[model samples]
Target: MLLDRHRSLLFVVDVQQRLLPAMGGGEGCVARIGLLLEGARILDVPVMASEQYPKGLGPTVPPLRERLGNAPVFEKITFSCARDETIRTAVLGTGRRQLVLCGIEAHVCVLQTALDFAAEGLDVSVVADAVDSRRASSRELALARLRQAGVRVVDSEMVLFEWLERAGTDEFRAVSKLVR
Candidate 1:
């Protein structure tokens, strides 16, 4: 199903400092996520951010954190964001059924979170190019598994364009600039 902007929530899970360098294609993943953030801002989509463990992994990478604005930022030790009480509550409170996901360690955090969200009956759409693991194979496998479990596997531009839903409007104009 196509994501409805008004019914969608953006979840950026643990794109931290210490963990990123080890990830394959991590920089490009972060860049795509930045595009998602920019598009979300233009479309008025709600964003929820998480840092796995701030004391150890460091903050949510300065570039992304800066774009987060006043969106709720939850700190958690849980691998699956859905398993964290605060993050789970915030997500449920948004009342949105469609979740657009991005973040790190696709085999671990991203994988578990996507599975949990799916189990909860949320329509989860993961931006494939916006997430990666330390090993390229692990990332690919996790994405394959997620898709097998019924998640919408998509790319960054697909999401932004879908969220825009049309051309010629001010939101579309602003969002188009981000992906371009």
Candidate 2:
């Protein structure tokens, strides 16, 4: 599907420092997610991030922190970021239709947030490769459930290329190198 840069927002969910290392194949997902963010930057997609109770889990990773230095980040006690007023307000304030998601504990924060957003009648895309649950079975179940519920599950590359869209835009060359 076409992912218009102006109509979409990237939501990085609860990929806190302590929780991150425990996600299955998480290190790889984190690095790929960083690349995804880079592509979004080149394409000019706005981004919002979240941390699930930072006092206990810590902040987002250093690489992501540096890239998104000034982007607003909300700390939440709820599993679903939709439950956090600040995050909800910040996301709604963006005036974007589609929410593209990526990050950790796929069955918890990622899954819960996607379900809530979808229920809010917003189009959602779960970047499969960019999300994790720490447990293989749990992630697999979450993905299946998300699909059944009509959330469009995708990979980082899909969102990146969709944002780029055409072959000749200035972002193409830079984004092309990313997928390879």
Candidate 3:
């Protein structure tokens, strides 16, 4: 299904500072998510972020935090962000049907959160290039399970272009520069 920008909101999962150095391709994942954030801003798609146990995991990394601005940031101990009251309320409050996901530890928090969102009847899509785990095998397994469970796995560019819908516009030119 084509993701409608009006129906979409970006959910940045626990891309924390302490966890990233051990995660495979974590830096690359951050870069990809940053691009998505910029595109989301240009498209006017609302964004919400979650930080898992910030005291232990640290904050949502410097780069992403800067982009977040005044966007709501939830702090939770739950593996499934959907279970966190603040996050659940914020997500439901948006009224956006399509939830585009990006963050760290694809096998754990990201995986559980996607499943919970799907079960809640929201259309869920995880940005494949913007998520990762400490081990590649774990990441692969999580993604395999995610597909089996009905969540759409997509890349950041696919989402950005879908949101843009066409080229030659001012917004397109701005968003296209992100990928380049």
Question: Mind giving the per-residue lDDT tens digits that candidate 2 earns over 86-174?
Answer: 88888888889899999988898999999998888789999999988879999999999999999999888889888887897678999
Instruction: For model 2, give the RMSD to the true fold.
Output: 0.9
Model 1 Cα lDDT, one tens digit per residue, 1-80: 78889999999989999998889898899999998998898889999999988999999888899899998889999999
Q: Rate the local accuracy (lDDT) of all candidates.
A: 0.91, 0.88, 0.93
Give candidate 2 misplaced runs (Cα > 4 Å).
none
Instruction: List candidate 1 segments past 4 Å from native.
Output: none
Pairs that collide, model 3? none
lDDT for model 2 comes to 0.88
Those runs of model 3 whose alpha carbons end farther than 4 Å from true positions after fitting are none
What TM-score against the true fold does each predicted structure earn? Answer: 0.98, 0.97, 0.98
**lDDT score, candidate 3:** 0.93
Better of 2 and 3 by TM-score: 3
Candidate 3 residue lDDT tens string, 99-155? 999997899999999999999999999999999999999999999999999999999
In terms of lDDT, the best-performing candidate is: 3
Give me candidate 1's TM-score against the actual structure.
0.98
